[model samples]
Target: MDVTVNGQLTQVPFGLSVADLVRGRLPDPRSVAVAVNGAVVRAGDWERTQVGPGDAVEIVTARQGG
Candidate 1:
């Protein structure tokens, strides 16, 4: 299936959960916060959160500052 991840279009395997996409595929998953289709998803919910075509996903990570 095709979905928009962090504003970029990408293809992922069917039946993949948010947790799988973030932890298994996406680089540096631990440092980022994820939102699916405009709703912020909690870490505990990732396993049950399923992604589909045209879904908009946002991933933001924290950065160290002086």
Candidate 2:
């Protein structure tokens, strides 16, 4: 399936979950936020939330500085 991630087109396996995406990239999932198709998905639901084709996904990480 094809989905948009952070404004870029990307292909991912079918039935992919938000948790899988975060685990593949971020070393620490504790400080990350995810939204799908303009809706925010809670951390507890990441594993149950499945991403589909043409879905817009946005992932952000919290950082501390200045």
lDDT per residue, candidate 1, 1-66, as tens digits? 899998889999888899898886567777778899999999889999999878998878878998
Model 2 residue pairs with clashes: none
The ten-residue window of minimal lDDT in model 2 covers: 21-30
Tens digits of per-residue lDDT for model 2 on 2-66?
A: 99999999999999999998898788899899999999999999999999999999999989999
Where is model 1 poorest over a 10-residue stretch in terms of lDDT? 23-32
Report, for every candidate in turn, its global Cα lDDT versus the true structure.
Answer: 0.87, 0.94
Clashing residue pairs in all predictions, respectively, total 0, 0
Top candidate, metric TM-score: 2
Clashing pairs in 1: none
Q: Model 1: runs farther than 4 Å from truth?
A: 25-28
List TM-score per model, in order: 0.85, 0.95
